[model samples]
Target: MAVLKPLGDAEMDERQRRMMDAMLVRGRDYNVFRTMLHHPAAMEAFLGWGSYILSDQNTLSVALRELAILRTGALRRCEYEFLRHAVIARQHGFTDEVLHAIAVGDRTPLTDEMAMVMKAVDELVVEGRIAPDTFERIRSTFGDHTAIDIVWTVGQYSQVCMFLLTAGVEPDPDVADDPLRPLFA
Candidate 1:
């Protein structure tokens, strides 16, 4: 159960309904977004930043970005984030085997680029900073701007997982049985 109950469509004010409608165009009324509607102002700001993070403006490939996000969710044990992003991750070409490997901290068979990104996520999640060698690798492969974006991606998703866990947010009913569930468990 969520610590804060999600507001249903009927329960929303006009502004909140519009926001929910806009979000629905992209997907369903995810419980996290619905719960966020309880505070309209904060939800507005969150939507903007969240949009940019998932957009092409972030410089990282969608695959890399989702990889970092999945790792963060697994590390934090945030089922909502892990399950939700797992769907998107699959759309972006992450196979089930790769997703499971990420959840369990296995990096074998991944491309050098992906392995480095996973290593960076691990270092950031566990140590709060990327080691120098990892930092150099990221910078060299993707450049300084992307290096920053990678870190930002990891940090942003880390915060998201923490919020979902702390709020006790529930996964959407449809995704509750996501295959990734047991990995997190």
Candidate 2:
């Protein structure tokens, strides 16, 4: 059960309602969003930054970004984050084989670039920073801007994983049958 009860439409004030409606327009009514509505101002602030991180404006490609997110969630054992990003990973064209590899921290058959990103995520989660060689490899391959985005992407999702776990957020019923559940279970 969620430590913070999610706010339903009928319970929202005008500002909250508007924010919820805006999210609905984007075809998402995620429990995270609904639950965060308990503090509308903070949710609004998060949405702005979150949008940028998930947007085309971010230096990382969607696939690379989602891969980092998935790995972070799995490492943290945040079931909600793992399952949610599993879906996003699929949408970004990650195959089941790749997803499973990420779930278990197996880099088999992945290109050097993919493996490096996963390594970076692990380093960040475990050491709070990527090693110098990994940092340089990422910078050279993806450029400094993308390297920074990679750090931000992993860091942002790491924070989200912590929030979801600490808050005891439940998985959205709509995704109750998420295939990734068994892998992380």
TM-score of 2: 0.95
TM values, all candidates: 0.95, 0.95
lDDT by residue for model 1 (1-185), tens? 67888899889999999999988998777998898888899989977888888899998898889999999999998889989999999998889999999888899957888899999999999999999999998999999988888888988888788778877899998789888787766
Off by over 4 Å in 2: none
**Model 1 alpha-carbon miss at residue 116, Å:** 0.2
Residues forming the 10-long window of minimal summed lDDT in candidate 2:
176-185
Residue 36 displacement in candidate 2 (angstroms): 0.7
Candidate 2 lDDT over 88-152, as tens digits, reads 88887888889889989999967888899999999999999999999999999999999999888
Model 1: what TM-score?
0.95
Model 1 backbone overlap count: 0
